[model samples]
Target: MINQLRVKQRDEYYSLEVESGSNLLDVLRRENYFIETPCGGRGVCGKCRVTVNGQTALACQTVIDRDMLVELQNEEKTDILMTGISVQGVLDGTHLYVMAFDIGTTTIVGYLMNGISGELLTQVSSLNPQKAYGADVISRIQYAITTDAEELRKMICGTLLELLNEAAKSVKIKTDEIALVSIVGNTAMHHLLLGIDVKSLITPPYMPKVYEAVELAMQKLFSEHTEGVVRILPNIAGFVGADTVGCLVATRFDHLKKMTLLIDIGTNGEMVLGNWQRRIACSTAAGPAFEGANIQCGMRGQKGAIDHVEVQDGKLVFHVIGGGVAKGFCGSGLLDLVASLLQIGEIDGSGRLMNGKEYRLSDTDVYLTQKDVREVQLAKAAIRAGIELLTKKIGISISKIEKVYLAGAFGNYMNPKSACLIGMIPICLLDRIEGIGNAAGEGAKLCALSKTEYEYSKILASETEFLELASLTEFQDVFVDSLKFTEENDEYL
Candidate 1:
């Protein structure tokens, strides 16, 4: 295959052999270097940039060569911090630490926090490495089913190792110093991390192999360094993972007496409806339309990504996240743009882009193609239908929702009023809506910081009832009704 290479950082040097096609990132991680390659060996994010023969190149982008010499770049000189779960007062004078890992389908966020103070020390996030295979979990599952299973595992594990190393380095500790880690993710994501086959999730049965708490030693997961234990937050059902459990915990749903709903919108949209009496959960495959994927010109919320779009004086005005030139549209920007168009009668209730003529705004072409409308239609239909079905299942009306918490990265940037115009959300719940950014991460952090919270999550997972949307007979009718926009007497807009 290939020759051995030497990698040096600080005062230590390591030798390793790699195949010719292997990238430096893979080699370094294999050697337990804890290099963070958030883009899954892709050339994006630039987090894995390193010095190779005094030249700066993305570790994931460069291939290994014979007798190559490498050094850690200036950005890579941070010390590795020990992190993980811990029981209070178990170890002698060592500082207690825990890590919360939000394993999202699109991105992963890690929080290194003190187990006692509830203070966040360091946070690290990056695109999920599995993105190289596909953007969503379903695509990744399909790839795993047809292509390579072991490779998928390697990719996921490698990405996690990078995150673990980065968090450790940021906090100036070793891997062994960390005590415990709690992770939150959807069903497919949880399955992938545990190396469980997910083919059953996509077909008729729609069953998950496990929905309870899973515990494994860190060393068992990684060969090079694994000193602590990893606790996967218990999942609710087929689609709802520990992430939803975290959302419930973060929002204190159990403490509320009134009816409430938590909707975390993403590639797979999940909603939880409950109150003091009982809690029920369901999931819908909303696709990547909202995340700026599977569209003509879509991108994630990053530099130059259009975050807001509206029509002023029959001309399009858009705001980019970094206030730079518009490169492409993000989820929030797409949602606002689509909703604005609908409000102006440019798009009908059926989501047809009208105007019947060419239009140009500020040197940029502005036109919603039939396909774009259809995409928004599908995304909105899934989310709205989910909300309606859950509310009906609980025998409550839209007005009965006392609070609605929005979770996920995109939700943090969305305009609630605009979201209502397109009927993506009910207008009555607009005032009660609050964006809770990365509740999964927060829940993970709570688990890291408190043993009580970790145990509470286990209890919550068991007590929470999961309702499979696919199995519900009235689900199709609710979905069809939700597709039509409610125009009259809506105040949330």
Candidate 2:
């Protein structure tokens, strides 16, 4: 049976003939409409909401049993963090133009630069299309194992070409005019971008197939897009890949004499401790809670999402993303809400809601449930435990660290006070904390600008030591201890 599906967004309408049982979410995505399915369409997150003939329904759960009129909820613009600390002193390169890419799990950002002058020409970003398969690396890896890996590779490669074309058009240049490309991402993203097998990434040792920097003919990844070479930065480990190396290069982590901690908190929490004398790196399975996955009312940072929460004059207040009614809570908002609740005695130290099973946001349908509290506990505990364990491995007290650098989007947008209050970051080091916006992207830009810096990234990757937290004997106990939402204590460190 065939059903006519009429889709309506604000002012535009799309009509398509579909099979009777076609999935609405898939249909929308096929037509190039934006909808986030962070849970891989499992219907657990409740984020994929749309209206079907005047009734609200979960897009993932809704099937086209009959001809229907579907109205998509207005999706607000997603604010992707793009700027980074400036990389000064560009050495002249041979190519007329070059492009650098930061292939993040959730987003991919590309920068077009003048190869000789290293002046930024244009920038473009797109949500990683593979997000339809899953939200995190593990979920996508499992999907690849069961399904086809080629599908993942094709999706990313197509997005890369699209970004390239968009950037070239923006700068009044042809795509073929670009001479060189540099890439950086976590291990899974690196492998997927290169179409390498990811089976090694999920095994017992959890190591990537390639740890050294690599190069490939651009034609191999994209057909006829450009006659150039693609240079990928080295991977440090399975979870920690070129993006972390990019962060290291951008921040000059290798040369810092002071004991500093660099943390990129996201779906996968990657951190490094120490400076010149000794450096140790580890990747914590922080999960996607920080990116708004798994929690009951969680969502990615987008329009209509409550990004910040506070108790103003004895009443709960929320700052929605686009000055609209609250639809859901993003990671930063979730953290702020939890911390505010803890401060007012609404939530106990063990991450329990005091008065009820859930705390409803005032004047909004959004609320945080008991299960949501546990999800925060699990996510924060992993990161806190990684921080403590990394310091233990380096044989240094947390107080001895002079500087703490928080990298990536979540790190920059999140309120530092709320982070400390929730115990995700140590309160003692709160005074030393700094937000370095998009350090990985900055590193990629540096790599594109200079051959010296690109080679230096390899040295940074080789010198840094990787600690396997799962293999550590004391990890379980420390992780359990880190689970509590207790006040910061000198003893915990």
Tell how far residue 195 is off in model 2, in angstroms: 0.4
lDDT of 1 at 261: 85
lDDT of each: 0.73, 0.88
Scored by lDDT, model 2 comes in at 0.88
> lDDT by residue for model 2 over 1-493, one digit each (tens)?
9999999999778888999888888788788877767777788777677889999998889899998889987766778889887768457668878999999999999999999888899889988988876788888888787787898999999999999999999989999988788899999999988888999999989999999999888999899765888889999998999999999999899789889999998789999998988789999999999898888888889988889988777666879998878888899999999988887778889989999899998788999999999989998999999999989889988889899999999999999888888898888888899999899998998888778888999999999999999999999999999899966532332
Q: Identify the candidate with maximal lDDT.
A: 2
| lDDT by residue (tens digit), candidate 1, 167-286 | 889889876666777788888888888888888778766867888878888776666665777888888877788888888777666777978888888888989999868998889878
lDDT of 1: 0.73
